[model samples]
Structure formats: structure tokens, C-alpha cells
Target: MNLTSVDELFETDASREDKQREKVLDIPLSKISDFPNHPFKVKADEAMLEMADSVKQYGILVPGLVRTKADGGYEMVAGHRRKKASEIAGKESMPCIVRELNDDEAIVAMVDSNLQRESILPSEKALAYKMKLEAMKRQAGRPSKEDNYSQLGNNFSTKTSSDELAVQTGESKNQIFRYIRLTELIPPILEMVDEKQIAFNPAVEISYLTENEQTELLETMKQEENTPSLSQAQRLKKFSQEGRLSTDVIYSILTEEKPNQKEKFNIRRDRIDQYFPKNYNEKQKEDLIVQLLESWYKKRQREQER
Candidate 1:
């Protein structure tokens, strides 16, 4: 009866089982659910189609990460793209690394994983950062005076949740705050920001307006066929804060000429090409025009001096 050898054998078996838990398992697609409120979009564009083709040929090389739910189904934490590709590739099951993560942990992990993507929409980052920041704050427990100040006012002190998020995402703390501000905007205005019709700084300022004011501003913009400049948006934000912003005020501000605005002159490409040699490209023509302008200016100066 060698009890020492039996104990050693049991220990070895336990280690093997632990290692097995870390290995990939073929999870039924029906058993896996998408992460709740997943901010990232999986578009079925050319790239996705190419990915599906690759998956069909070689199978999924990287295993997806998932956690078991109470009802025994799995919830995907990462690899949303892979999951979709697998489905397109006609896979009944996907290879997954089963993990155990709580709500806050899952949120942080999900944000961290998706933020590495090459092309993320602005709205996605805004919502993801907001989710991660809230999760971080919850993990850290009760709100401090610093949280109150950051939420109520523009000033952010040392190492706020936004600051920590900035560190994680490689964005400036101010930029993170600006992105979060976008969440307050009406959906149409926010969508305009995502579409790049409204610039980031102007959109940030516009986010401070109330919903009714934002709708009014949108109408004014549509009527004028113009978006706000940074300075104009700042003025709008100021007016909104003071409760003085109205449709009339927005229209007036938008209609006012900007100090540095220039009247644009248009010349047809054919009209410009006739003045230059046949071999001259657009850049060469532009250089020649600039040279002629400079020469004319110098000649005028000489005549005035004489």
C-alpha cells in the first residue's frame, strides 16, 4: 500500500484536468448568445465575405471567448466577427475558450478587445467608453466628490474614470470627455457627427443643447444648408446654458458671416487647361498661376514706386 505514489498520481491527474479547462472546446452555435448591448457592428461587407471564405477553407484558427450563463448557454465576450464568419461558413459549432467573468469584468474585457479594431464608428466608441467607465466606477465602488465635479462641470481632476479610460484607449482625457458628451445629443445630431457632416469640436459643443433646442438647430441647419463653425457652436452652447438659445438666435448666429470666411471663385478645369501647355498637369498649372500672380504684383509695385 504505497499511499505516497497514489497521492502523486492524483495530483498529476488534477493538473491535467486544469490544463484541459484552458483548452478550446467546440461550442454549439445555438448555445452561444451575443454579449448584451454589444456596441460593435459586424457588417457583411466585402471584408466579411472574404473572412467567411477563409473560415470555410481553413476553419477558425482563433477560438472565441465565452462564459456560461445560468441556464447553461454560453455568452460571447469576444470574437464577434469570428462568430459571424463561422455562421456564414455554415458551421454548426464554433471553437471557444470558456471563461468565467462577472458583469463588470465582461464589460471591461469586451471594450478592451473591440477597441483594438481598425475601423470603429464614433458612436461605437462613445457608447463603449461610457460603458467601460461606468463599469470601472462600479468596480471601484461609491461615487466620490471628483465624480460629481466631472459629471456636473467640464473640469476633470487627477485620474478620474475618464482619465483611466484615456490611458486604456490611448485617447486624451479631454477627448474621452468630449466623446462622452456626444451621448447627450439627440439621435439625429449624433448620427450627423458619426457621418462626419458635423465636425467633432462643433458636435461636442452642440451636445450641450436641450433636445428641443437641438431639433430647432437641426431645422435651421437644414434651411441654411450649413453646419456650425467651432466659434458659432461655442456661442450656441453658451446661449443654451443661459436659457437664451432659441430657433431665431440659432438662425441669426448661423447666418452671421465668419470673420475669416472668403468668397470662393470657381474655374472650370477645361478653362484653366487652355492657358497651359498640353503636357502641364494640374499641379504645374497651379504653380504657373502662382508665379504669374507674384510677377504681376512685383510689376505693379515697381510702377507705383516710379
Candidate 2:
């Protein structure tokens, strides 16, 4: 109401507007580079298509975060999916918040930003945890307690880097290490874990097998048409540690069926994938196969009756 009060209100409004303007910028997609070894995937799946459609109609409501690179342009710290969606939406540029961040800070920010997604593959979480844990250790300048790689089975104290990550991410320190161990698995085995062909617990135990032994196990699995259960995998690990594991030993262990283990028919995905549409997921392909099989069986029954 007074002259002084009016001037103060006007100054506050001007400062707020200036701050808002400084926070977001319309950055070109070409000028932005994805983060190095970004663990999160930006696939053109159903959700991504929906996001692209939304971006097309409404524009990018939430701005991406990036930091300036030394060479030139900007490095994306978050919002990789947004970038891809914008591209699909025929957008040349999207809103972003530019900031100054060191390598460690960038790594932490990237992991934190992506971890909240509803669906994350086991491999993605494994690599992301390893990267973020290493960055957290570096940021501290000295190892607190996680340096004891062999003793990860033991309960970690509050002073450890893993403990801090556990608190921040709501994953137990033991579970975090379990996920991190997955990084040591061979790509084929890791892919199996991602596809849900291998259970998570058994896969973690299998990670302890040496590369050669793992190769042997994979071959044995193919020959037997069965995968190792958790108990079988633990026995393999024990044999490997005792220095007695061999191709024969792996075959022997894998062949001994567990209680209630029934015979299973296995088919390599690549062999059948050619018959299905590109967008068909595993369930859809399976349903179609069952439908075809039922039709063939009914036709055979009619012919036999004749």
C-alpha cells in the first residue's frame, strides 16, 4: 500500500523472474552428448512412444540437467529418455538446466536420477551401483570400509561407502553388493539373468565361477537343457574354490536333477525370433506358438479317427 512497500514487492518479483530465466535454457539436441557409459537404456519401447507423443503435443514440461564440457558443448547428466523422446517427436531443442559438476558429482547425479524408474534390469542396477560406489569412494578421498572386497558377506558398519549408498537408495548393503557381484558374470550368463531365464539368487552364486568353468557350465546347461538351481550353483562354487572343478564335474552336478525337477524343452530365442514381429515380446510369441500347436493337434486327431 505504501510507496516503499510497493518498490520492495516490485524488486522481489524482478529477482524471482531473473532466477527462473537463469535456471532453464532451450538447448539443441545436437549440442548435447550422452553421459559416458550411461547405464540406463533409452529404448523405443511402448512407454517411450507415449512419452514422445506427450513431448510432441505438450513440449518438455520437465527440463533436463547438463554440465558444460571442457572441449565444447554440454554433457547430459540426466534426462536421457527425454532426449530420445524429443528426437522422436521431431523436436530440435528441449529445456535444460546447465550446471557445473565434476566427474564424481556427475556420476552420482546420473545414478540417483535414473534409479527411481519403475523398471530397471538387474544388469543396469549392477553397473550403476558399481559406478556410483566407486565415485562415492573417490569423492570421500579415502576408502572408509568397503575396500574389503573379500569380506563383503560380513555386515558393513555405518562408516562404509556401501552403507551410505544403502541409506540413500533404500537397498541393503548386502543386497547392493549382491547386485554389484553380477557385473563379474559373463555377458551370456548376464543376459540370461536379464531375460529371467536365470533366477537372481542362483545367478549371483554363479558369478563366483571362473570364466572357463562358467563356459563349461554354459555348455553343460545347453547339453542337458537345464540351468543350475541355487543349490547346484553353490556346489559348483565350492568345487571351484577347492580346485577340483572340471568339465566332467560340472556335467555331473548339472545332470543330477533336483527334487521335483521335471524335464524341460529348451529353444534358443534367435532360432524362433525370425518368425515373430519385431515388437512381439516373449509372452506374445509363446501364446501364438501354443495356438498353432493346438490347431495342429486337433487336425491330427481328426485324421487319425478317419
Roughly what TM-score does model 2 have, to 2 decimal places? Answer: 0.81
Residue pairs with colliding backbones in model 2 are none
- The 0-to-1 C-alpha lDDT of every candidate, in the order given, reads 0.84, 0.89
**What are the TM-scores, per candidate, against the unseen true structure?**
0.75, 0.81
Candidate 1, residue 135: Cα displacement in angstroms equals 0.8
Q: For model 2, state the Cα shift of residue 60 in Å.
A: 0.9
Model 1 whole-model lDDT (C-alpha atoms): 0.84
The 10 consecutive residues of candidate 1 with the worst lDDT sum are 144-153
Model 2, CA-based lDDT: 0.89
lDDT of 2 at 157: 55
Highest-lDDT candidate: 2
Top candidate by TM-score: 2
Q: Which lDDT value does model 1 have at 265?
A: 55
Off by over 4 Å in 1: 1-20, 144-159, 259-306
lDDT of 2 at 14: 68
Question: What tens digits encode model 2's per-residue C-alpha lDDT throughout 252-281?
Answer: 998886999777677877788799999997
